[model samples]
Target: MKHDIVIVGGGVPGLTLALALAQSTSLSVAVLEARDCVRLFKRDARVSAITQASKRIFKKLGVWSAIHAQAIQSFTRIECWDEAGNEIDFHCETLAMSALGYIVENQAIQFVLQEALQSYCTAQIFYSTKLIALHEKEDAIMLSTDTGQVFHAKLVVAADGAMSFVRERAQIILDKKDYNEEAIVATITTTAMHEQIARQCFLKTGPVALLPLSDSYRTSLVWTLPTAEAKQYMDLKPDDFCKALTCVFSKRFSEVVVVEGRQSFRLCKQQAQQCVKPRIALLGDALHTVHPLAGQGMNMGLLDAAALFEIIHTAIAHHRDFGSHAVLRRYARWRKADNFPMSVGIDWIKQLFAANTPVISLVRVSGLQILNRFPTIKNYFARYAVGERNGLPKLAQ
Candidate 1:
């Protein structure tokens, strides 16, 4: 089989890119997914905070309405504080937007994108198919799958995730940092209503975030802790876990009555040394991974997809090879400029908060207090958070 583009991994990024191209361009696209379509719809306890820019991208693809109909929790305010009693608050009113962002289940986004692709997309998706080897030729790249299928494409995209087979096969070096921490994720019903607000508390150990859900009393929790400490928390009974969590959260939510889908994963930051090579391009977690303290990972991946789509669309309009190094390099430079600084900023914030010394705490608290007092500066950060930065792709606008 041959196509103009082949995307490895049918996750949100790959599927979004495939759908975008299929809807707006004439490229013959294909997606290689290692799991069956039914498996993709299984309940994913994880949720993502979709930025305004990402929402617009989905809207352009004509699937945002379907996704919104399924499930969505819109939050207009964000409150973050430290143990020192210093807090910073952000409101959507600062940007004249109705909502700062929407929190949606990861599975919901994936299901909607997959359904849209299957129903009307010209692109083809192959389930139970995995890329085993890829070789780049002068005019096209050859991909071999575990199912003994061979595919040729003018361009190949690696959205397979952090442990990307395509990235490894391409020999892209990754700069990595292990924070020696694990993030405990769960869905909990609290005694107090979240009031459509997203909240985060910085503890001596790490940060814990409560993201508002559709239900007034339900929120998603992401608590970062040292690896060993995380295991101890995971081993506790649900009641005991809730008690400990409530204490650490300063009882802001009153009490965590029901905790479901409790799980933890190690935390790390990784960046590929190069995002593109000849006919191959990397996006999403394959290109970079950041601390989730800000809930920007999914949004970042969405932007990457949108940006790449715009670049390729322009190339095709000019009758240039979209897979050429010249065209791919443009994408690499564009994303690196936007993604690199954000990655570093998130990592820095994580490290700054992780330190609990009196002086360090004082400095951070003072910084938060100062920033909170200045609405203009706070609004600047708020704008960046909602993906209102300049140079956004047409889809995001």
Candidate 2:
């Protein structure tokens, strides 16, 4: 098969980039997905806290409507409290915004991106194909799959996720860090209806965040705990698990029961040492992994895809070399500037919130009070959450 661009992952970032780039007259694209097709409504225990920037990108890619119904409008505010669940509040109104951001399910977003890609006649979609080798010639990149099929393209995108084969084959190094913790995520039914407010409770163990779901009464939990404890929680029966959770999380939202299945993911900080490698480029989890505390991992990946598309599209429009070092370097520069800070910020949050030091607790609590006291910083965050901040591609902006 022949294409201008070949994306190795059929996940959200790969599919969205294919759709976004297909809009440009200069490129023809294809997405190679290794996973079997997933059906809608299958419980995706993972939920994402999407920023305003992510929403705008969806609108531009023409999938916002498909995702809107399933998305929970999170206009109220997000509150973080100490272990006691008291002595604090942070309101969205402080920034003069109706909602800070929105909560969306992982499955729905994947479905929407898949459906959106289907609308692009210029893009080819492939499933169950895994890249096995990449041979970069003078003018094009060749990709071989495990099935022995080969593909040639002007550029190969490495959206193949955290352990990207493309990045590995190209010999790209990653700056990686691990918190020695695991995040246990599950969907649950809450006795108390969530009033559109997101909650993150910082405990000595780790941070537990409750995200709103489509239904008023349901919410999702991402609880980061020590690796051993997370495994223990995963092995517990539902009744015992809920009881143990309530002991730490409390009865603030009664009737808490874990969904049908639960999963634990190791928490880590990893960023690609290089974002662009000759004919190959990296995006999304392939490039960086932030702590899930802020839920910005996917958002950062999508932003990378958007920025790359802009750079490639501009070069193609001017009839310049789109795959040259000059063209690819621009994308690397843009992504590093934004992804670097997010990686650091998330690490800071992990260290800041997980400590049991009395002084650290005092500082974190007082920090919240001060944060709420200043409308300027609050508004800055509010704008950034909504995608008004900066570094977005033209289409995303």
Most TM-score-accurate candidate = 1
Clashes of each: 0, 3
Of candidate 2, the 10-residue stretch with the lowest lDDT total is 83-92
The positional error of residue 197 in candidate 1, measured at the CA in angstroms, is 0.8
TM-scores across all candidates? 0.97, 0.94
Q: Write the per-residue lDDT of candidate 1 for residues 1-397, one digit (tens) a residue.
A: 9999999999899999999999989889999988888544555569999999999999999999999987799999998888777788888887799999999999899899988987655699898897788898989999998778999999999999999998998999999999899999999988889999999998888999999999899999999999999999999999999889888765465788889999899989999999999899999999888999999999889989999999999999999999999999999999988998788788878878888788877788777877878888879888987899998889999
Worst 10 residues of 1 by lDDT: 36-45
Q: Which stretches of candidate 2 lie over 4 Å from their true place?
A: 39-41, 71-75, 84-88, 255-258
Clashing pairs in 2: 52-386, 53-387, 75-99
